[model samples]
Target: MRLSVVDTELCVGCQCCMFACARRSGLGGIASSAITVRSMGGMEKGFKVIVCRACDDPPCARACPTGALTPKPGGGVRLNASKCIGCGRCAQACVLGAVQWDDDVNKPSICIQCGYCVSFCPHGVLAMEDK
Candidate 1:
């Protein structure tokens, strides 16, 4: 399954999805979340929900020098933390900027397409769908 943005217009910038994503990793803050919510400028301009698009051939995976990231079956990538060198290349390679950084561990916190954040979207702005 892949997480999708169902409707950006519905987003209120509450960042509940971000919080839920972080919670799934047993973290207490948005710093670890794979998903992000940002204002366009102000509340009236709506919000942008940033998350992995599950690219078929992800550039981030291609940029992993240590073979730490491998492509998932459907889309996106699976990160092997043990092999990661924390080079930050994956984050830079991702055009969507979906590869989030974890300053504490110095590793990328990528979405596993687990859909944990979907349920927390009060505005129905997110969804999980089969590939």
Candidate 2:
């Protein structure tokens, strides 16, 4: 399963989803989040939610020289932190620009599509669905 953008038009740009993602990692800020919300251009243009689509064949996994990245059953990839050398290869392989970086740890914060952020979204802008 993966997250789907239900409706971008309804987004109010509150960034609750971003905070929720950070909270999932037990972090106080968005630094470790796998999701991001940003303005398309300005506040009036609404926000763009940047998240992993859980690709069927994740490029990030293939780019892992240490085999740190492994694809999930439905979509996306899971990082084996033990194997990750903070190489940042997986982040570079992400074509959709969904792989968020953890500069302190030198790893990409890829989404597992657990829908934690979706629950926090005030507007119905995001949803968890079968691929």
Cα lDDT, all candidates: 0.91, 0.87
Q: What TM-score does model 2 achieve against the real structure?
A: 0.93
lDDT, residue 37, candidate 2: 82
Give me the runs in candidate 1 sitting further than 4 Å from their true place.
Answer: none
lDDT for each residue of candidate 2 in 37-57, tens digit (9 for 90 to 100): 888899899888888999989
- Give the TM-score of each candidate: 0.94, 0.93
Model 1 earns a TM-score of 0.94
Count of clashing residue pairs in every prediction: 0, 0
Candidate 1 has its poorest 10 consecutive residues by lDDT at 24-33
Candidate achieving the largest lDDT: 1
List model 1 lDDT by residue over 4-35, tens digit each.
Answer: 99899998888998899889868688778888
